[model samples]
Target: MIKFESENVQKFAEACVDANSIDELLAGFNHLEADATDCKTWGITPAEWMDAIKAATAEKIRIWASENECPELLKAIAIWKNCPLEEVEIGGEGDIAAGNKWLDDDGLITFYRWNAATYGEAK
Candidate 1:
C-alpha cells in the first residue's frame, strides 16, 4: 500500500518504477514486500501517478520561480556594469540585437547593448 501522507511521493514513484507488482514496493522503509502480487497492496494507480507527476512538476516550477528573484535582464545589466564586455557596439542603426540575449543570445553578460527587437525575458 502506498504510504499515505508521505511527502516523498516523487522518491517513492521513482523507486517503484521497475516494480512489476506492489509486492516489490515498500511498506515504509524497513519492511519488505510479500511475494504475493496483491493489487490491494498497490496504493497508487496510473491516474494517481500522473497526478503526482503533475503536482511535482508544478511544485518545482513554483520553487524555481521563487528562487530566481533576479531576472535575466537585471543580471545582464549587472554583467555589463561589473565586467565590461569587449567592443560590441552599443547599437547598430537603432537596431536591437543583444537585447534578446537575456533569453536566447549569449551576449547577455558580455555585450554592452543590443538592438532590442523586444523587451527581453527580464523586465
Candidate 2:
C-alpha cells in the first residue's frame, strides 16, 4: 500500500535522484517503493507503478530546471518548461561513472537522468 499520495511519492522519488548525494538518492527510491506498497495495499497495479515512475521522473526534470537555472534536464527529457508534464529516462555512462560518490550507476538517481538508458533493482 502506497502511503504518500501518488504525486507526492513521484516528486520525492525524483528529488532523491537529483540530490547530489547517494544517501539521499537511496532514501528516495526506498521511500518511493514504500509509498507504492502503501498504495498497493489498497490495490495499486503494475500499470500504476509505471505511471508513478513516469510522473516521478518528469517531476525531477522540473526540479532540474528550477535548480540548474537552465533547461538542460528538461531538454533531456523532452519536456517543455511551461507545458504539460512529460517523462523521459535519465542516466547514462556519465551518471554510471559517478557511482558511490553519488550512487550506483544504475541507481534511481542515475536512471532518472534525462537520457538514462538502463535500470535494475538495487539488490
Candidate 3:
C-alpha cells in the first residue's frame, strides 16, 4: 500500500484510485485545491500532491497487471520507467529477460510504454 505524510494527500490518492475517469480525478484535485490551506499546513505542496497522485495511479496499474498475470504490461511499465525488472516487484511466473527480448524484437511502442517514458521516473 502507498503511504503519504499528509492526510489530505492520502485521502486524495485513495479517491484517485477509486476514480473511474479523468474527470473524476480532476474533480478530486479540485476538491484538494479547495483545501489548499490544510494541505499547506501538512507541508504538502501542489507538486507533491501531484507526485503522490501519479504514484498512486502507477501502483494501481501495477496491481492490475500483477493480478491479471500480464507480465508484458509490467515489462512495458518497467521499460518505460527505465527501472530494472527485478525492482518492479511483479509477482508472476513470467520470464522478465525473455519478455524484454521479445519487446525489443517486436519494437513495440504502446501507450503505456510511451506515456510512462514521457512522464517522470517511477516512484
Best by lDDT: 3
Model 3: per-residue Cα lDDT over 1-123, one tens digit each? 358776767876676667644334334444545346534654567777665555454545444444554556556556665767665444442222323343221122233335445654322
Model 2 regions lying over 4 Å from their true place: 1-39, 70-123
Cα shift from native, residue 103, model 2 (Å)? 26
Clash list (residue pairs), candidate 1: 95-115, 96-115, 96-116, 97-115, 98-114
Where does candidate 3 clash, by residue pair?
none
Q: What TM-scores do the predictions have?
A: 0.28, 0.31, 0.44
lDDT of 1: 0.33
Worst 10 residues of 1 by lDDT: 21-30
lDDT score for candidate 3 against the true structure: 0.49
Stretches of model 3 off by over 4 angstroms after superposition = 21-44, 71-89, 92-111, 115-123
Model 1 Cα lDDT, one tens digit per residue, 3-113: 435444455444443332222221221132322232124455444454433333323322322344344634544455453343122231211132333221223212312
Best-performing candidate as measured by TM-score: 3
Residue 44: error of model 2 in Å? 1.0
Off by over 4 Å in 1: 1-42, 73-123
lDDT head-to-head 2 vs 3, winner: 3
What shift in Å separates residue 106 of candidate 1 from its native position after superposition? 29
